[model samples]
Target: MIIDIIGDIHGYADKLIGLLTQLGYQHNGQCFMPPKGHRALFIGDLIDRGPQQIKTLDIVFAMLDADVADAVMGNHEYNALAFATLDPEHAENYLREHNETHTRQHEAFLAEVPFGSERHHYWLKRFCEIPLWLETDSACFVHACWDVDSMAILKPLLTRDNCLTPQALTLTSKKHTPMFDALERVLKGVETPLPKGIVMVDKEGTTRSRVRVRWWLDDLDNRPIREIARAPHSAIAQIPLDTKAEPIDFTLKTDKPIFVGHYWLTGTPTPLSTQVVCTDYSAAVDSGYLTCYQLDTECPLPLSPNNFVQYRHT
Candidate 1:
């Protein structure tokens, strides 16, 4: 029942492979399945801005197909899927512009994705159903924030937003479209009323559907990202304007453990607030490396002196 949570891959398949290999995976000739009782969890962003997008997806999809791994749909994956549905023209142009050997490999990887298949949908239902705030028997996992009142409250919201009926969750349906399309619209909106934040750009490098919201839930008065932060990444990390913000930005409560990977810090972990911790060490930035956290305390690696590190098996 041990969980080996991974961070964003961003198309670095070789690193993922190396890391997985170092973690003691057994290749069944089709995919690398974890040793019995070990489970892998992906934090998403499996593709884009890397040399081996296809290979990355191939590894992920293979592990996923083999039921040895679980993945949460990342904002990037949401963006790509939304791009396919909302703005095919721009998406195609984007593909043409950045599409390379890796893209071709990625294409083949996705070709056999079997997105809405029974088993895939079942996993998708469970994954998409995970809350923005996750609480495990041993730790907590979240892609970005630990906002909602607690994991209990976050579960329903996550489930409602992510999980859907087989038909509703299909990539072809409109119901599911909005699940990811909201990001597109947020990224596309041309009007930046906030004048101080993020202005998102579509995959096609255009701004057609744009809008913004302050941070988590402080004051989502409906503004666009452009006015929130000059840079998209900043906008993403920007704490909404409010004085009543929580003491911590939402993370380790000092009562439990927290593990996350959206900030991209590759080498070292960061303790933003007294309680909040970030594990994303920007492993996908270069060929240098990527990371995995194994939960075996009896034989843990020397990565974290802190006890709350996420788990991968190596």
Candidate 2:
């Protein structure tokens, strides 16, 4: 089967359209129809830090509803859902993070997402249960980085978890709350803070954002600088290299293809062992283009968000 995996969209629906065209994904109205058995998968971060957030939601939700695509949640989406309880000021600020001119638009989008009936539900429902690791006997897909044996531990979790049903695992085993509940809190004006000692760091080791990105550390994906340098792009910024605690060690359990994202890849699309792959080119920011890859064919095509078309007006 030809599996098409897409990296972070970050509200760039128009840009995604261009990439879809290049990837040969045909369209019907606002929905898309992939070639038979040519399914699509998303690496999440479906909202925030960009314009047209709702449009992004509309397209992905439509595609998934149409059974043309599958998706996994990203940190941003997690934050959005979490902010749903952060009172008015925080909620407004969260909306402002992406320069959302219409808060109601965001409100509507969040309301439409299906978080599902699962207890112990840490992670969003719709895409959250898609499994951190996807594996066919011949392939696998993960969103972030891993080491020599990271895939080994992942296969069982995915298989035992059965990411196929998506809804099959109501309460995600990730030891966290689902995005739906968290977002409800934000909209309700609840205060949610970053993890302890996770103060953002800069080149000179200074704090930057109010929040942090260290979930992988708890997921057993951490390593010391000495150990990390062995991996490709270990020194890449936004990688959260300098942390006190670390995550558990992992191993690749299968000889299948693993498509993943989360880390912003700049130069080349490095494959760990012909089975592991990353698609995130950090599309939502000023850094570079969004990316998508065909699992069966193994092709990466870069895309450009077309907000520039409206830049002159702003």
Candidate 3:
């Protein structure tokens, strides 16, 4: 079977439809289907940060329901669930505090589906059903990093079908817990503390002291800070090499291919490594493109730009 590994679609239904069409998927009233027995494997982040949130969800949901596609849960989906759920300890508060920052991050989604509406609750139930990752005989897929150790720690905690249960979500939501750390590493990627008194503004204009590291790299001890960052910044290269920071050991080696989408990358899409591919090309932004990787089951995965397909937003 040929699999189309798709990137994050942050409410850009038009681009998604365009990409599906480009991949020879025809709409059969309810959902798109490929003619040659191909399937779409979505990397999640299906909602938020765009104009058509509910429409996007409908398409993705229909595809999944029709057995045309499978998806992993993105951090946005996790946060959405937490935001909608009331904290058991504090009846008035949400699992994820409903502060300005949290609300703003989810504003687009909430605008389309009101917080307590029937539609909101329906989707929340579906969101919780999404698995954090998918592993097959030949490949693995996740929203972010596939840290072996982290997944090992999370394996026993997951439900029989490899999904996070309500109790698991609550446990992972707590600060400094092993579950929290493992979930963070898998969903958000590995992060490293910046030098003393150093902070950088993220895409949301929030200043953060910790930056997501390039977890695919196994040897970070000798690498420069700029080289170790997944989202490199001009200021990061200026940080002193002697600055103390925690060491990251990404020692997961596998022959099977791995696909992920979360980092808002731009430019022409390509395989991250011989066996690793990141299809997210900042599709939520005006200048970004919706990207995908076409994988053939008969052959071993190739690290080339030729397999990358995209639909540019116009």
**Top-down TM-score ranking:** 3, 2, 1
**Per-residue alpha-carbon lDDT of model 3 for 172-288, expressed as tens digits?**
888798889999989999888887787777756777888788777657765666677766465465466656556775666677888999988888887777778899999998889
Off by over 4 Å in 2: 85-133, 145-248, 297-314
Error of 3 at 95 (Å): 1.8
- Which candidate wins on lDDT? 3
Between candidates 1 and 3, the lDDT winner: 3
Could you say which candidate leads in TM-score?
Answer: 3
Which tens-of-lDDT digit does each residue in 1-314 have in candidate 1? Answer: 65677777777677788777766777788998897778787766676666776567768878877778866555555434333332343434432133454344345324444434564344333334422334556655565544333333223323454432333223222323443333222222112232344334532354322333223223333433323322345333433454122222222233344555565553444354433444455665543246555554233333343533422323
Estimate candidate 1's alpha-carbon lDDT, on a 0 to 1 scale: 0.48
* C-alpha lDDT values of all predictions: 0.48, 0.49, 0.85
**Considering summed lDDT, which 10 consecutive residues are worst modelled in model 2?**
305-314
* TM-scores for the candidates: 0.54, 0.56, 0.95
Taking all chains together, the TM-score of candidate 2 against the true structure is 0.56
lDDT of 1 at 47: 64
